[model samples]
Target: MGQGADHLTSNQAQVLDHLRAANAPMTAYQLLGRMQNDRGAVAPPTVYRALKALEEAGLIRRIETLRAWAPVATVRPGVVVICDDCGTVRGVEAPGLLESLHERLVAEGFAEARKTIEVHGRCGDCAEDRA
Candidate 1:
């Protein structure tokens, strides 16, 4: 519910609402299918536009591994986690770790650097299933 919502069309708002309501990440195609089934018909571009806006606003994130999107409740910068098996993602808080790494890099005189720490592994359900 950021200022990004103000820029969204009603269609975009509807798409964002649906994505937030979903329990799992969903591809644009999947969202399009649901919209078509419920609203009778929908265009692909509309979904893409809405997703792009939501992503830019940091209200949602795209899971590269799953090729899907999910809402982001927290925005603690410099943190990202991804489940390798199911592709479920969660944001984390690791300022200490990040600070340590940053200090080390600064000592080495690395001026510009961005951090994206992605941990890949099976989620709880996948681990249980495998077990």
Candidate 2:
């Protein structure tokens, strides 16, 4: 993780640490609050700059729907999963999933640029509670 921080500025490292410690996804504003509360001297622009660096490094993902972010698990490859019901986000490893989809798109004469897979439905706890 130190090596990852080496590529980022001090502020970015701090932001990444906060995101990694969080139990749930956090918005940039939430991160800014955390920085201000914890560091007591950090500025808002610092938080945003850090977030941008982490996003560029693929060390974290921004949840478009919720406009929040969650740390990428060390064991998982880069994949984002968003829960529709509670708006919780999780990361998983589905290595070839995107590649296969892109291939199929090309076969159908459609050029795929970017793809965001948002599976909408109740999460396990929510489903069980409803049942």
Q: Model 1, stretches more than 4 Å misplaced?
A: 1-7, 74-77, 84-87, 103-115, 124-131
Q: What tens-digit string does per-residue lDDT give for candidate 1 at 1-131?
A: 46544576777777778877776678999999988987887899988998898888777777665778777763235566666776556777888988899888899999745565656666688889889
How high is each candidate's TM-score? 0.71, 0.75
Task: List runs of model 2 lying over 4 Å from the truth.
Answer: 1-5, 74-79, 84-87, 108-113
- Predictions in order: lDDT: 0.74, 0.71
Q: For residues 43-125, could you state the per-residue lDDT of candidate 2 as single tens digits?
A: 77777777778877767767666777777663234466666766666666677987787789999999876566655566697
Clashing pairs in 1: none
Candidate 1 lDDT score at position 77: 51
Q: Candidate 2 versus the native: TM-score? A: 0.75
